[model samples]
Structure formats: structure tokens, C-alpha cells
Target: MSIMLKEMKAGDQGRVQGFAAGGQAYRRKLLAMGLTPGVEFLVVRVAPMGDPVEVRVRGTSVSLRKDEAATLNVERMP
Candidate 1:
């Protein structure tokens, strides 16, 4: 089953599907950060409070807030 990016924990891997809900600007921001569809990424870490989480994507690490990450639909990979 598909899951929201925010549901994943560190070491989890998944491929981008599409945005769940966001404005054009927000979506553009995600895309600019390399969170485009079909891209594979790893959940690198999550803050103690679980506010902002870091993910490894396209050879770089990007930090995204739970709200923003939640909008990202993902197909978890084994």
C-alpha cells in the first residue's frame, strides 16, 4: 500500500508518486528540491520532535517538515 512520506522512519526507502495536497508554489518548491515523481529517496533522519525530517535524494540531503512531507505520496520499497 502507498504511504505518506511523513509515515516513514529512518532507513525507509520509497519512490515518489505525487503530491497529496499543496498549492502551485508549494508543489514547485518540492519539485525544486528534487522531490519529483518517480524519484527514489531514503529517510535519513527525523528530529526528536518529529518536526523536520531529512531525506537523501538525488545525491543530496533535504529536510522537509511533516506537513510538507505528508503531502508527498510514496510507494514504499522493500
Candidate 2:
């Protein structure tokens, strides 16, 4: 099953499925950040205010805004 990226907690592992309905430019931006479909990522941290969520992707850490993370559809890994 797929869930919004923002809903995932730290230490969770998941694969990027795709993006939710939104802007093409935003999609392109995310893609450039290595969030392409089928890519796996590990949730590293979530701020106390829950504004920025950090994840390890392609061997690098990326911080995404809450709304930006929400736009990603991801499937939890076992």
C-alpha cells in the first residue's frame, strides 16, 4: 500500500512511487532531487514543528518541506 511521504516517521524505509496531482515544475524539482519513482529512501528525521522532513536518498540527505513531502506517494518497505 502507498502512503504520503509526510506521514512516514523516522527510521521508516520506503520507495518512491510517484507524485500526487500537482504542478509539473514541482514534479521536475523533486525528480531532480533524486525522488524519482522506484528510488528507495530512508526517513532520517522530522522536525519538532513537523515542517521539514529529512530523508536519505541516493546516498545523500535531503530535507523537504512538509507540503513538498506530502506530494510524494511512497510504499513502505518490509
Misplaced by over 4 Å in model 2 are: none
- lDDT (tens digit, per residue) of candidate 1 on 1-78: 778888888999999999886546568889999999999999999898888999999999999987788788999999
Q: Would you list the clashing residue pairs of candidate 2? A: none
- Compute the lDDT for candidate 1: 0.89
Q: Model 2 lDDT vs. the true structure?
A: 0.92
**Strongest candidate by lDDT:** 2
Kindly state the number of residue pairs that clash in model 1: 0
- Output the worst ten-in-a-row residue range by lDDT, candidate 2: 21-30
TM-score attained by model 2: 0.94
List the candidates' TM-scores in order.
0.91, 0.94
Q: Model 2 misses residue 38 by how many Å?
A: 0.2
For this target, which candidate reaches the highest TM-score against the unseen true structure? 2
